[model samples]
Target: MSDTPPILVVDDQEKLLRLVVMLMNRIGFPEVEGVTSGPEALERLRERRYALVISDLEMEPMDGIALLREIRADDDLMNTPFILTEASFDFEDINVAHQAGADAFILKPFDMAVLKTKLKQVLNSKPRKREAPVAAESSLSNDFPMLGKF
Candidate 1:
């Protein structure tokens, strides 16, 4: 993991956060960091550079969409790759995340293989900017082949 970039994961649920961190480690990302809130995520982002950020969609004070927007607004962090994860499929929420510059979206209860795919896709792609909303279902299916299973 010395040559690999670190990953940051944000989820308010402690158990979920730890689970994700563990899965990321198991999937070849040994330098995974977990934070409990968006504010803490922002603090970490400002403090260090990360290869990617995977955040839960429903956190308080600052949800994933809000955090993405904040990251996009900042010139220094505007190009950071981000993946937003939600427990349930909500079209409106997904659309908002797209508009906020999320690199990818994953529905929760995902296995390690699904997470590995998303991490690879996001990390290999160029940085993205906030864009107009698109058809959420089509966008999700195109990006995540296993999305229909959830």
Candidate 2:
């Protein structure tokens, strides 16, 4: 990835997805990309490197947590910064995401200022270069939300 790689924003809501993409581009990520589903987001990730991923917590087929888990399980993609958002999350849900290694969390409607700050933080997080061999693979599953209260 280059110094400032592109960004990916995932949300099933088209309007909010566009809004996030527009605002991110306005705030410095001119290559911001948006996808409406978790599967599409995964496909995009396989296609190119992304500086950050900002995803909504709720989605069909695969939610943000499932997307995050899949990303984490991939050795090539594990270090990418992830920022998950929601309207409001139950306390337990927050903890579950935290344990799963979310880089940042934001509650919507997004405050432009806070969003910018988080974007900067995650985009700037340099991945550690590892000389060691490939790490053990962890299985990917979409059962995260069940561990948390709705």
Candidate 3:
């Protein structure tokens, strides 16, 4: 891994993904990557080490909740800071995301300043200890069923 912290942005919307990438760059994250689906996000995770993961809660095949669960279960990514974003601020949605292991939840139509603040907080938090690799293997069974529809 490079000295600069890597950030991963995951969303089904291509435009939003690009926008987040641009924003992170502007906000001073030197290394950033964006992906459009949960599977693609996992692929990226396996290939690199990221300091933070910002994902959208809703999507076609796999949602952010499912992605968060997978990340939490993986020993390598268990402590990775994950921020879940949603257009709606439904309490139930927030609760679900929390249960799935999201480090923070941000409502959509968000202000860049707020996002920057949250990013800084998460990035500044104590780093998690690296765990032994758990094979770096993912199976369909581990993925949410709804993801297949997409």
Q: On residues 18-69, what C-alpha lDDT tens digit does candidate 2 reach at each position?
A: 9989988787777888999999999999999888889999999899999998
Considering only N, C-alpha and C atoms within 3 Å, which residue pairs clash in candidate 1? none
Please give, for residues 79-108, the per-residue lDDT of candidate 1 as tens digits. Answer: 889999987857677657776778887778
Q: What local lDDT does model 3 show for residue 43?
A: 90
lDDT of model 1 at position 100: 71
Models sorted by TM-score, best on top: 1, 2, 3
Instruction: Report the number of the highest-lDDT candidate.
Output: 1
Task: Give the range where candidate 3 is weakest over 10 consecutive residues by summed lDDT.
Answer: 136-145
Query: Could you tell me the TM-score of candidate 3?
Result: 0.80
lDDT by residue for model 3 (18-46), tens = 88888888877868998999999999898
Any idea what lDDT model 1 has? Answer: 0.84
**Candidate 1 residue 42 C-alpha distance from true site, Å:** 0.5
Q: List the candidate numbers ranked by lDDT, top first.
A: 1, 2, 3
Which residue ranges in model 2 land beyond 4 Å of their true spot? 1-3, 126-150
Shift of residue 73 alpha carbon in model 1, Å = 0.8
